[model samples]
Target: MKKPLDSEVFSSMLDASISYWRQQGKKGVWIKLPLELSNLVEAATKAGFRYHHAEPDYLMLVRWIPNNTPDVLPANASHRVSIGAFVMNSKREVLVVQEKYGRFSGIGLWKLPTGAVDEGEDICTAATREVKEETGIDTDFVEVLAFRQGHKSFFQKSDLFFICMLQPRSFDIQKQASEIEAAQWMPIDEYAAQPLVGGNELVNLITKVCLARFGGTYNGFSPQLTTSASGKQTFLYFNGHFP
Candidate 1:
């Protein structure tokens, strides 16, 4: 819908459309409202509309007419969040482990230590836990270096991964025998030169980026804060956009 809606008549106009859609045997109705028109959107909500999703430019509102309709919003719409530890020691060697299971199993593809984030888990803390579990090394998360998303993750669930830059506090590699075939502190140059990584164009590119940002030279991504007019705490940044 257009911006600067006629708020005075929008409620009536929306109600009339809903009534028409119901009489015409329409199963559902979707109304796209621009992000600025919160008042008009609230009017539609009282008229029995529910949210589907929100993109940067607009918000999606869906209305299901049928009483027997299944949920319009998916129950499992959430993506699985995981963290990867890009741990480095004093010698600038990165911690990597060979997978004994999962997608890259038995292929000798070295990857940073990673695992699924448990419920109520702090992302930074989870990074260290995964490193300990896989490599038997104590590490401290310094900052988030990068992140990636996979739309077609296993079982068709979406995946969100955080690549954390960590400082290795303790040494002595002990690979988790079950899931990890071997773990080691490979020199960054040697790790990047591996055939499995170097031959793969994308992996090699990412390895270079990680190596470039190694150490605290590329640190500090802390979110800025702000106070609302109503004396409430609010995030200054939303979905990568500054308000």
Candidate 2:
């Protein structure tokens, strides 16, 4: 059910659903809960549902009716989330980096610094870390400029791509020895005309979108990780990250 009513209504609905699905003798049912419906989420869980995979905005909860079946999630639901930085310098040049090894290792396709988000990493923080790792350029993340998801590219595995706009603070391009071949601040037009950057439809559009959204302000949000003397890591989102 889409965002259900209040908890009482949802409880009645869940009761009816359980009665009906039990009569049908089917395998299972899935409750897709938007992140906003934490109350309903709790209600569902209290009704014997369990956690499943999650998307950027939605949470999936599942319950198996079959006595023998393990709760099987959608096979394609496992998507890896990643971040890319579109860093622009005061000179109007964007930070581009060449990977030491990848699909575009030697093809000379300079891309916006991109990397995988760690298990507990914050999105904007990941973007800034990726930029610093790939190009040795320190940046303050502005905001998420654009996102693209596709299964066409990677062995039918879905990928979530967050392209962010960042302000360049430090300029030296000390490329990471292991992963980066080289890094440079290239003129926007010059960067776009290149093969990989220009040829890929999603990449091209996100770059354009980032450039278009550059001047306009965006209130950036990132999770704050704090460590105490006891050696524990705590993750907290900006509560109201985006204004």
Clash count per candidate: 0, 0
The local distance difference test score of model 1 is: 0.78
Report model 1's TM-score to 2 decimal places: 0.61
lDDT of 2 by residue, 45-106 (tens): 87888887687888888887766767665543457789888888778799998888878898
Q: Candidate 1 regions off by >4 Å?
A: 1-71, 215-217, 220-243
Q: After superposition, how far is residue 36 of candidate 2 from its true place, in Å?
A: 41
**Can you list the residue pairs that collide in candidate 1?**
none
RMSD of each: 12.3, 12.7
TM-score of each: 0.61, 0.60
Q: Please identify model 2 stretches exceeding 4 Å from their true place.
A: 1-77, 152-156, 217-243
State the weakest 10-residue window (summed lDDT) of model 1.
233-242
lDDT, model 2, position 127: 85
Model 1, residue 4: C-alpha shift (Å): 54
Pairs in steric clash, model 2: none
